[model samples]
Target: MIQQTLTQLRELRLSGMANSLLSQIEQPATYEGLSFEERLQLLTDSEANDRENRKQQRLLKAAKLKLSAHARDIDYQHPRGLKQSVMASLLQCHWINKAQNLLITGPCGSGKTYLACALGETACLQGYSVKYYRISRLMLALTQAKADGSYSKALQNLAKIDCLIIDDWGLEPLTAAQRNDLMEIMDDRHEETSTIIMSQLPTDQWYQSIGDNTLADAILDRLMHNAHRIKLKGESMRKIQSNLTDGEHLE
Candidate 1:
């Protein structure tokens, strides 16, 4: 009986050690020697870290669905850096009560899309919902929804997100019907939620691209009213990175 009791105690101690080792492997900063309070802190930290990583992964997946094709790897320290006002405005998005809009305009490869995605991800991280979609895909989706008699449901879903990013505006001229659908969305979201628009074309040319004088005026009025507008000016990061890689290979 004495031997059996000793064996049972030994098994229990070994099991405890195994569990501690598993915990350490899963969370490198935690260990068996920690005090009770320290252990609680470590657990909290582990959970928070897991949550943040998961959030970033989900946001990246949603951005991919919109064909963003880039990470929110914004370099705030560039020579021709983002304007201070723009950065401050983006950080203050949580305080915006009226569904204000943000517009980013630049030539090709000027980081317009990247900045917009980064801002949208910021809104997501701050506990607000976000949806990112390309302008072309948005129009096509509306067309299909109209055909299938699901247009109202689709619009409802779009309106629910806290922040919506419409990318690649002015890539192609919109038809009259397409313009009307876009106006409906903008009007619905104008006072209730925020929006981000990334376009390569200047604001003055939007009337020509959207194909409706009234919509062009109304949409621009809502979007520009107390809106934050940023203009990006820089060469294409892709081309620069490619050239750097080629130079390193030659060396």
Candidate 2:
């Protein structure tokens, strides 16, 4: 009867319950102690938890973030313009719910990617889908997609992501074609989905980086006006890490 029940549970896709049932039957002494309601509760909770865990794993795999960082691991001690209070508010994820964009600006090695990844991970945990891309790489892929007749499909895919993290936003120069492509992407995501852009350049220089004055104006109007900004300051973290090899802490 137990073997038949385990097979039935597996057939019904109740993997969590099947495993729990096997464990319970293996230890009849313990199972005899729990009330019927407690046993049922355990099986139900196990199934629900397993399902949630699988969903989260799927989300994290799809995210493909540059850094494997979590919000709780954020370094507040580094005086790099990060504010724990602000981060705490952001962690509540209210801005994402409202479809607000985040702009993280800083010098090289200021941990922009780390912070962005942390937030992206948070979004994934909250059941929001996320995608990450470097602007240069994303643009190249877009150009390829256009040649293969999947340009529109690519944009549609980008539009569907709940959160898009564009790392190294201003690293590459934008051509006329790339500029238009960017406009389409931003236009689709505007006021509907959240985007986190990490750039080493100051926000003011972004206009110059993304040349074509008219296109720049339109793109910035969409991405900047309603965005929350974080400007990270301080020396390169790389420098600090390099000094740690001598076994002395950075002062």
Candidate 3:
């Protein structure tokens, strides 16, 4: 009878509850003292938690973040000008709810990508969909979509993501086509979704990098209008952690 009930639960797609039930059956003495209502509540909570975990895993896999980072693992001792208060607020993900943008600028190897990925992970945990891209790669994708006649569909899909993380921003000058593609993407996401931009250049220099004054203005207006900024300053974290640093020697 118990095996049949477990089979029924699995068929109904309640694996969490089924597993919980199996555990209870195997250790009857542990749960025998609990009231029926208490046991039922435990099964319900397990199923809900299991569903949430699966959803978060799907989101994280879809995100494809460059780094496997988490908010709890962020290095606050790196002297990179990151503020605990600001990060705490951001982790709550209220800005994402309001469709606000985030700009993270710093020198290369200063943990900008890590921080951005950490926030992206947080957004996933908070039940928001996220996507990460390097500026060059995203431009390549859009160009390919145009050639494949899926440009419109691609833009629509991008517009639906709750949080978009663009890493390596302003790394190269934009071509006219890339500029137009960026304009389309920004226009679609403007005021409707959140974007986190990681750049090595200062915000003021982004205009020059875009290469077209008019398009730069349009893109920046959409991206910066309601954006929060973080500027990190310090030596390269990679250099600091390298085994070949000045005093470190190989035996």
User: What are the lDDT figures for the candidates, one per model?
Assistant: 0.73, 0.91, 0.94
| List of clashing residue pairs for candidate 2 | none
Top candidate when judged by lDDT against the true structure: 3
In the range 169-224, model 2's lDDT, one tens digit per residue, is: 88888899999999999999999999999999999999999999999999999998
- Which regions of candidate 1 are displaced past 4 Å? 1-72, 77-81, 95-97, 244-251
Which of 2 and 3 is ahead in TM-score? 3
Supply every candidate's count of residue pairs whose N, Cα or C atoms clash at under 3 angstroms: 0, 0, 0
lDDT of 3 by residue, 1-251 (tens): 99999999999999999999999999999999999999999999888998999999999999999999989999999898999999999999999999999999999999999999999999999899999999999999999999999999999999999999999999988889999999998999999999999999999999999999999999999999999999999999998978786666655
Look at candidate 3 and tell me the lDDT of residue 219. 98
Candidate 1, residue 8: the lDDT equals 63
Runs of candidate 2 with Cα error greater than 4 angstroms are 243-251
Question: What C-alpha lDDT does candidate 3 achieve relative to the native structure?
Answer: 0.94
Candidate 3 regions off by >4 Å? 245-251
The C-alpha TM-scores of every prediction are 0.72, 0.92, 0.95
